[model samples]
Target chain A: MDHGQIEATNLIDRYLTNRATPEECARFEEHFLDCPDCLSRLESTRGLIDGLKQQPPDTFQRRTWVGFMGWIAAAAVTTFAIFRPPPATPPPVTIPGPTLTARAGPVFTLATVRGAQADAPIVTVSGEFTLALDFEPAPGIKGFAVQVTSGTGEQLMSEVEHPLSASGTIGIGLRSQDLKPGLYRAVVVGKSVDGRELQRVIFPFRFQVP
Target chain B: MQSSGTGQSFASPRRSRQDLVSAIVSGDRSAEAELVDWFARGLAIILSRIVKDHQTVEDLRQDSFRIAIERLRSGALRDPDALPGFMAMIARNVAIEHLRQRTPGALSATAPDPTGGPSQYHDLARKQNAAIVRKILNELPQPRDRELLYRFYIADEEKETICERFGLSALHFNRVLHRARERFRELFEKRRSGGGIVPPLDAPDR
Candidate 1:
């Protein structure tokens, strides 16, 4: 039940993977309840195993293929539309005013790492941009709670129970005009159905308006 | 015994288990909350492993806490040092009882249904988690190491078999796992403090 025993037996991983005996399970659970370090390790190991379970063989390649096909299909449709013969009685073409395009500003995929180092990722954007926050959702989490704040502690956005996309990434659209160019952090918390906070990830980045 | 890779010691100064038990027996509401807060996550992790149904796991967790508190208040616990083991036992009993009820021809009228499917949110979460795992697997320096993890964790292959196939000694097997887990922990640290972030995908080369 001690930490040594737990490590020697890989008890945390075994317990999570359901490979432990009943006695081992009991001993490890009891030990972890009293040992915060073990408890945290148990949680992290559980997350890792649960995540691995969700992935089938070739999951990444399959998803990448699907994404690639989607882009190809979109491009084909665009090409067909552009090259198609003009309609016999086309309506008068009207010029549109200056407005935002369907696609937002530069899309930046922000990587959430261990901490804020001197070379923290920097995103140079103008007008509005999209921040893609990638995270490993814990098993059984129902929704994610996200909060964005400036380095100075100014709250920018707060959301509870935000629905996650199928890609395991959530895109946050922010206007560069509203944010001053310093440091900003986004905290994404995965919550269970009962609103329990299961896992949390922090993404820190510097915003530069060019 | 060593501190976790996160470098934050969870064994910081806190009320002893004996103090917690005595406070609870003395009708301290804060003590009750503290006890629940301390053990709730661990209990849930334990119970969820036994019970597949999310709702049932939740119900059993609450029931375990209630029963433990009741016993504590009634002077049932003999040794304050045995609090963790005692709570774990209570949770296991609750989960087992629920499982027994779920057995064919054993379910009572009041027994909660066990046939419910995972919610949509659960499915999405699984997909998201799978994506992250894929990223981690790709980051591994060796494909063989990735395969080792996949076989051990996802394939549920036996450790002995995996080690034999990989030609790794028992110590080496443990080392691979320990290293992978440490890397996983390093990337997965919650509320990480100051560190350098990777540049955006499209950022110009420095």
Candidate 2:
């Protein structure tokens, strides 16, 4: 076996024997977490503790029952405690009020959009971004949609999923790596599933890639 | 709950609630022992359902007994004859407390993959935290409330047990457990605040 494997085995040995220092045990657990074979062995070894037989309490204890009951009676009789219930507190009142500036429109003006760093680790590895939207949302435009595209016009975005109903939140985002270092155009569409009719607007925007 | 008190040496699935209670109160060591024995099995089953750390559960099983025995010795048991119920209560308090005391985050919670082994040290640490929390829980109310909840949750003991012990139905048991937990939470919060330690809550609720 390789030295690394041997080291792992020794760590496992320490763990099984319960001789491992806490730190060593933590290290061993971390090692086995990524190594499947060792994890299985650890599980099988730990299974033996399950076989313990269940037994009742002792006869000596039971023999103490009459005396025990006597003690309980004695304890209760002398413990003449009077607990008057405390007056209950009233529940808090919640007051809902109206807000002044509810939907004053698109605060996220395109201040500046940047591209990903060339050495960025694992771009496109995780998360969702809006592909296309016709325009910035107005009053109640439900959700906006954009036809995301590569400079080559190849579609690089998934079909627009409802942000509120399906995903619960609406966020505007873009991809950095998949596109060339120039702006490509796409139209945004706004739609809604709330059954309230929404105006759809599509807007074209520049795409940048680093 | 079947009485194990006959020539056949068999536990009856047909035992009445009173039969179980009577057996226990009669100083039948077997009754108390049965309660403890059954408690471990039932708790192991409930715990295994909620948590996958079998090793930790094993250790927890032993700790449950240790706690129950201590309670029994000190007369913390609400109803000594209702040992099974008492055992279950102790077990639940121990389990919940241990679960709470887990050091912050032991699991590497990055979207659990399909073919994965769980974190081992994390489990042990989590169990250790739980044990600590249970110690704190012991400091809250007497073992009876703890046992009542345990009988309700972990042991999944039938309402019949509750009926036999408390002379109340399942619904009353449910409400009682709920209130007991609330009381525990209240005590915990009080301790967290500047509120000084409340004496062991074993202040006996009739």
Candidate 3:
């Protein structure tokens, strides 16, 4: 399968919306696996579908009013609202905040700090947060084993063999409350399927709780 | 390795389908990993469309890969070039069997849970992408077009029904979809380049 065939059949859209037959689905998948362009398109289209589903019913609704009658109606409503007495204040309601999951935190990309400490990327994090380590994986490297440590060489977190995204990034969520404000380094080692290390990259950053 | 018009090179090296199959069959670990890496994302996307739960989708993906490897090793696949199609078929069948097992009045066995739930990375990516898409949808100028997208993609309504409801020709319907996808790609590229949360490594920081 090629881009021509993909466009001719509208395979990306159909496959995303579940409108494609099994045969079409198989063919498209096969094509995209080796085709980055198709893979990127598939991701964006899927994003569009997911975004549309998240929208409320009234998202696309439009409201229109007629001519002079519309102006008069609007004025009347405004006048009534201005003249009407405010309703009695309701009792204060205390609603509990929604519990925060690991995903509820803000994500920040951690990059290698090449020069002085003052030039290192500093992130102000409160509560839970995620640190995204982005790197280009060597050919045939599919995953990474990530280990994070403080400036003092104290190990903070370690994750074994996390899969790399198609866009070549891995994210690790952490809590600010767990560590003191200081510099940290993420030791990311690319790994093959058999847990063999291919390459190692270090990202240094500092976090201050505010 | 095929390069796109944009000059982006694919990571997978160019190898004949037969060579890859033969390599895997000869107990080449690199070949196995290469095969998995090539098809993992596509398989995940395909299975995720059919299965709702992230954990279940991941499980099905693994099952598909294992089954495909076993079949290839046994010389069950006649056409080496049909490997992709065969992988897709295996993934779909795995997903279907999983769904069938979960259905009521079917043979009752404890369903397997793989990896417990979706990884944090998957969840984060989904949330980030959805936010970008929502922004694009809101900025869409045409209410009709927005409604058409919602009805077609989200509602899963038939194309003919959508066209009739919107009083559009078949050609127009296709145009709307094409334009929407193009618009999305434009914004997605912008986000990637403009220092968004998940910017590429070389992207300049704000």
Candidate 4:
């Protein structure tokens, strides 16, 4: 807090900017050791630098601070739950959770997206989505299929085969070019080799694309 | 740009995966190069865990990526979101098969028994060091550079923010971000090696 400390505090900015010369760095270091004030200043500046570096450059907050985001999400959810309401008399909306088989998991599904425009290109849409699936790998059998539905509520595609070796995104390309864009949904039904619906897991996900 | 409907966090992985797919499908050579550049280290890590020979692992790492690219081109890899993971699995299985074929009786032929032969600690340590290096980049002098590095590369920010701030199209932003990441990687590598912070990774150099 004296003149030297005051000067040292300012010198940090200079050193960081690389404007400080070797002599200045040496001078700063010598004073830094003797004066606790400069030492604290130096550490604080380094801390600031480290803080700045680790931050997600797009935002002032760093990723290490990402833990706080959980709280934010919680707050949003809480607010939505409190303030958001159902559409006026929108007859008791029903979410149909898919019927689970006797298997341990949900069934695998293959699907595609379309646009409202007749010429709406499939290129505008994406195929990545999560599947609630019942995995019943029959030893050496490589592929399995459930069913597929088009955006128009029609069974435009079905019996799509997914291999066991493929765990991530299995590619079901737009096999048919004559697809119109609209709301599409699929019901993935499955059973084990014994033809009994398994029941261990029934994970389900819903999403949309343009 | 995506709608505020989905929010930012959810937008990134989906959007970028889409960008990569679009670029590859649209026949952008630079996108292919960028994908290779970003994934080289990840591929190397997968290769190391599988292949025993150091030289062979590096070669196989490159080979698997080439295979991945071929798959992308041929539409074998239909979904872009799982591209990297799929490629790694292919590399992993290939190495396993090669080891089994080479020496069925040799205990060392397959990947090291995950239990103890190799130091899993070293693997963890390397990951920590990389994280620390990422931490250091934010400490650099330039604010814009920090912003670019964090959002574009580390946090894996989507194309939207770049579009907002820079007003660049997807292709333009992709080009810029790709170069920015390269510069940042170079800086990170320099600091990492010079800091002499972590000793040469002790994972048997495999």
Candidate 5:
């Protein structure tokens, strides 16, 4: 390996092992971001280290729980095997996965929704109004996903990374005409840079038109 | 500090986990809530170590509980005492699944599928890999070296304690550890590449 590549590899090793100096760490991060070779080495090296560390020590040598762990693993596999349905079949009800509670209290109102539909309570009003959901932007999260779905789970509107207010909330103007009257659900999902869903919260509301 | 639904402390002391599991299994919603309340912070801490983002940690924290609850309700857990470990495994799996989904090619070929079916091949492969790792560790020749590695990485013992056990200065111990880890890495790579065994590189995003 060339001198620079060798040095980068060393830095990466130290970085992973927590032995890198701050200056070396900074340099390593900058170089790896632009260098795929270094990145791959870093990844593989991590894989090697983390892989070894994760194996239970007793399992490495002759130990008793080895069989027990195997049984548990088998049981886990069986559970998923039995519970998971075929790809073609859909579940009857989509239960919302457990999610983090939003940091702030609910702020937006369906006042316009209530006012416009008072005369004809069931029909959605045809107008625009501000819709805001309160939440704190979690650290390291690139963005949040905001989606509006019908009570029966039909997605109506979806947007990603809608900007968060300085006080940590999301505000979007909704046009009532775009929404039909009835119950609708609004969900916000926090996402990481790689687009993993982090925290999800739901707001159930009703829309009416007159 | 994240507060769960319960007005009580997130880390509030709980009844026996066995009892809690039984109650939850028997359809006690309040027991389930109490269990969720008890485990929320612990799960968050465990998840945050691997998953750096607060938002993701919170989400995974909830997922771990949900999955644990589901598994309990479905008779997936045969031993009640294994609940904590089971929950931990589920949380780790949830994080790994997230990583696998985002970058399918990034993971090694042998990585476990989040929703895969039961396979005897996977079991055999894991046992073989574990045996290989054990063989490599056994070849170290020095008991202290082996002990140092075990305490430092696996047991996650404190640095000072590890240093005292080895009669080495902190700086010396780190250097020793660096070399030890490098040796382990070399042996691991040799085995993995030669045997076509894939190493797991999946770390929850920080």
Candidate 6:
């Protein structure tokens, strides 16, 4: 191992042994998340801790696995148990014969959207750019349906399943020329099954016709 | 229609941390927004360890970032490289303070506290995790290595003595220990990911 890696291992040892200070542990975390080599090394260090605990008191009872086969088996067992795969999404609800699908909840609720806005957060916009509306859905909201309208309530653009960026903002490609360069509002409506509105949010912004 | 109002600026995702610090200090609105967007997730992870409530976590994240920006403006941080860790420490302090404010005496059982002595939930895994550790330990190649690990870990032996017992210099011992750890991790991850394992680098000669 290189000098840096050795140092990282030492820090890992200190961390696992409960000897690392808050600052040291914090530094270690920042490094490990970005360093694959360090992560693999830490994995082995973790194994040492685990393997030591399974030691039997009697030397005779200290059974050794035959060759590398036993070692491989052990790895399989330990790894599978530690890093279980994420749960599969439930299948879409459908009635057997008629193929009817039913969904609950209101089309959109200001209350629910307000609650989700607290969690996922609503990233507001400024300046002249494509209007983007993104927000976290209240519980059980499957997808979002968004609409943009002018101050006079003229529906300008409507979209379904508009992508929400990692920062949680949805985009509407409305240039200054799209709407006579006036004040406009993007209304994001959250929906569950059956096009039910879970909640709605209005984002108001102004743009000048270029 | 207004042309380039005060709040008018392009939202940019390419701002570097230093750029963010500068922009935030200079009161650039777009830069401030970008700073929040960049640091919020990282802060959320750090704060979530101490503050369980999602609302409280978000609140503390914002508060920490705000404090960090203010500190930067005041020239508190000299090195830009320490930004990530510094930000994390700020978030941690904020969480700790929040806990103190809410419970008065009940500190979070998951982090470091002034009083100390296992008040934090850190490393307090349940029995299942312990069992997993034990299962992995049984696969180690050398019983001596296993013994060495046990003494150092459970028995809490001093490094000086462990090196002496192993008949190696401190530096060499550290290397051996590193290799041992790496080998163990290879086995562990291979097993966890449900992949077939290859030969062990340090498998004991039976």
DockQ of each: 0.13, 0.01, 0.14, 0.02, 0.03, 0.08
Model 1 interface Cα RMSD in Å? 15.7
How good is the docking of model 4, as DockQ? Answer: 0.02
DockQ ranking, high to low: 3, 1, 6, 5, 4, 2
lDDT of each: 0.59, 0.36, 0.60, 0.39, 0.49, 0.47
Instruction: Give me the overall lDDT of model 6.
Output: 0.47
Interface RMSD for model 5 amounts to 22.0
- Per-residue lDDT of candidate 2, residues B46-156 (tens digit): 333223345566667788777765555555655433444455556556755665565222111121222234356543433433333344335434434443433332222
Most accurate candidate by DockQ: 3
TM-scores of the candidates in the order shown:
0.55, 0.24, 0.55, 0.27, 0.31, 0.36
lDDT of 4 by residue, A35-143 (tens): 3334333433332333333332234323212223333445567577435442232111112323211100111222111101121112221121123332222222223
Interface RMSD of each: 15.7, 24.8, 16.2, 23.0, 22.0, 21.3
lDDT of 3 at B31: 80
Model with the higher lDDT, candidate 3 or 4: 3
Score chain B of candidate 5 by TM-score: 0.47
lDDT of 6 by residue, B1-206 (tens): 11111111222245555666667667787876765765565465455435444456656777997898788777777765456667778887897777655543221112222222321222222122344445445555654555455445533345676677556577866765766666556545655677434222111100
- Candidate 4 docking: what grade? incorrect
TM-score (C-alpha, index-matched) for candidate 6: 0.36
Q: What is the TM-score of chain B in candidate 1?
A: 0.76
User: What is the DockQ score, from 0 to 1, of model 2?
Assistant: 0.01
Candidate 5 residue-wise lDDT at A189: 76
Write one digit per residue (lDDT tens) for candidate 1, span B78-135.
8987787899999888877775555532111122333465556555545554555567
Residues A1-210 of candidate 2 have per-residue lDDT tens digits of 232653434443334333344455444433332233443334322221110000111211221232233334455566652233222321111111211000101001120111111111111211112221111122233444445564566776654533221111133444334544544444344455454534432223443221
- Report the error of model 3 at residue A101, Å: 24
Residue-pair clashes per candidate, as listed? 6, 23, 0, 22, 4, 23
Candidate 6 stretches with Cα past 4 Å from truth are A1-9, A15-210, B1-15, B20-79, B91-132, B165-176, B187-206
